[model samples]
Target: GDSDRLKVGELVASLSYPFGRESSLSFGIISRRGRSRSVSAGFDFIQTNAGASAGSSGGPLVNIKGETVGMVTMASQNGTMGFAIPISVIKNLLPRLERGEKIVWGWLGVRVSELTLEAADKLGLSPAKGVFVNSVVAGQPAEKGNILPHDVIVAVNGVEIDNPREFTRMISGAEAGSEVRLTIFRQGGLLQRSVILAPRPQESGGGREG
Candidate 1:
């Protein structure tokens, strides 16, 4: 199945060996689409109500026609919700893995969160948009480029962004060592910064890149 064509409310099934038992199938609908949570890296996830357990990671999430649409990756602690990595993500990674090439994710070295209406008002932004920089890692590209905490990143390379996930995806898509322009709003002023991205470290500290 074309995962891109998947829609919310579509019925799907997750196949996995929960608790080391024999292969099991759980049914549910796609609860949400294109969710990028803090815990997962790279691609956004397909949120589902399907039952997934500890042993369900890496199992196939199929549609009504038995076509693999996603791969079960994680679940909520109470087992009420599940998240699946879209098959499109696997499709992109498979070629690299097969060729024995290392998957290099670009890093900006800054933690960011969604900009709230209150924060936007405080920042004097007419529209409540852009991601708010929570912190900048010392000696990293963002810090080196003078990105400070509380700064609001309005755009990347002139492309306006509205959320941390969008910003993260844009940064990760760029090649390492490439310089990208950031449009920022700070202290009721606008500015731009050119920062050279670095390779993402093996262990990330928090959400929204870096």
Candidate 2:
């Protein structure tokens, strides 16, 4: 499990203490920075290629500067890839645990799809990059923010989104209650708007309210 430490670019190191002697070492950049798979009580994880092994459980996954980032929870079967819970996830839950706060994953209420080259061209996206809005939940932040169906989203918080996944990734990474700026290409022109972020609601829950 990650210490849930969400350091944007924190440097750290990983130390493995196996029952036997000798420690292994590997390094790579943090890939896919964002929130955890779940909202309520989870931390975003760091995707890495660090060599982690059995008996390395509860070990320290650090950054380049030796800061603790996470632990070795699981690894790829072929031993080619690895992942760790972000340190921030641990930090957030730690405080809440001490305070006895119960949390649940939430949703922001929007449906989106990847902008394929065809879709992008149809939407008038020059280089065929951006997220396409499929639908907006009624009364949700997206709807309230005036993000309508068929809008092509190209950027969030000044970060360009080349795919629908990137759009969700950017939004999920934002702090709740923060106003997120968006660059949307609608019908025929480029428009900018800000949407306040909220907890993401579960998809299974239906009938979106604006």
Candidate 3:
């Protein structure tokens, strides 16, 4: 059994066998909880400075309550940081993993770019934020929900969206067929639409947030 739920800034303990020192342990705060800005596209990472060294890969990252939150995946080249794949990602793929099936993320089918200051001002957005829709896949959830190319997505299920990556992170994390309310800015007007996310199929052309 393992834990999948955790929060940002939560205290965590890393159980490792650094340099074969069995029963070794290290402590650190969760420095970041969202998608890693450094990596292009992958699962969200739990960033920390927990001194994970050789022989630490696959070790459990437990919370202060001794609940596993993530598993150490890799270390930075500079040795100043460590990256862990959130247990939720693993939990979602476990069944497929057991069945020897390929894993895929949820798809929203909208190509988007970060909202630029120029576009924001022209679009009457007081602050430049969120992301601009570039295109929508044919017959996908976005097109069905009237998510157009010019629309700027401001929030998802009432959670404020800041950038393209964050938008992708939120949507991918959502369960397929789950209803999501999207708050959008279009032609100087605010609109809301509920969309049902779909599972991204292997080799399919699912749009990306840029």
Candidate 4:
């Protein structure tokens, strides 16, 4: 089944062994599509109203035609909301996993936040776009590349971006040690910076932002 074809309000079911019990099915509709990567533990997920519990993670989320569209990942404490990693994401990683390759997340070493309309106005921009750099980790790629705080990242490799989550996805998807061109806005002027991404560290410490 095409996960990309899934839409809000579409009926779906999840098969899981909650509480270590036998596999059971929970029915629900797609409450939301395309959960942000930042909020979904670095993977894009779809929000469902499906009831899931402990031990439900890694179960299949099936559509009406009995096609697996996603994998159950997590549920809210109250069990009212659930999230599933879309099949698209799984498909992309399957080949690499099968080849025994370790997943490497690209690191940028910068903390960023949303740039609101008010902030955009003060910056003399009409439309609010891009992410505002909050801090740069010392000795990291961003700092090494001369990316400073107060700079606005508007594009990556010439592709316009307006959301921090999107930026995270783009950077994390890129291979480590690859050079990327960043278009930044600073002091009402636009400039470009080339930064070579580093591999994400296992233990979170000095730099962790993707």
Count the clashes in each prediction. Answer: 0, 29, 0, 0
* RMSD of every prediction: 4.6, 6.8, 6.4, 4.9
lDDT of 1 by residue, 9-102 (tens): 9999999987777998889999876543221133456878885567778789999999999888778677878888777777777877899977
**What's the true lDDT of residue 28 in model 3?**
82
Best by lDDT: 1
Ranking of all candidate structures by their lDDT, best first? 1, 4, 3, 2
Give TM-scores for every candidate, taking all chains together and pairing residue i with residue i. Answer: 0.73, 0.61, 0.66, 0.70
lDDT of 2 by residue, 1-210 (tens): 343445444444556766666875656555544454333322344655563456555666776656776766555556654556566666666887798875544344578887788877776778876777888878888888899998887876566876654455456544566667789998878899977767665544332221
lDDT of 4 by residue, 107-167 (tens): 8888888899988889876577888899998888999999999888998777777678667
- Between candidates 1 and 3, which one is better according to lDDT? 1
Worst-scoring 10-residue span by lDDT in model 4? 35-44
lDDT of 4 at 194: 93
Comparing 1 with 2 on lDDT, the higher-scoring candidate is 1
Q: Which candidate number would show the highest TM-score if scored against the true structure?
A: 1
**lDDT, model 3, position 2:** 39
Candidate 3 clashing pairs, residues 3+ apart or interchain = none
Stretches > 4 Å off in candidate 3? 1-8, 13-28, 32-59, 64-66, 72-105, 204-207
Candidate 3 has a TM-score of 0.66
* Candidate 3 lDDT by residue in tens digits, 1-210: 233345567788888876666677888877876442211133456777764566667888888778777888667667767777777666766887799975445677889888889999999998877889988988888988899998999987777887785677677656566677899998888999998777765565333542
Query: How much is 154 displaced in model 3, in angstroms?
Result: 0.6
Query: By descending TM-score, how would the candidates be arranged?
Result: 1, 4, 3, 2
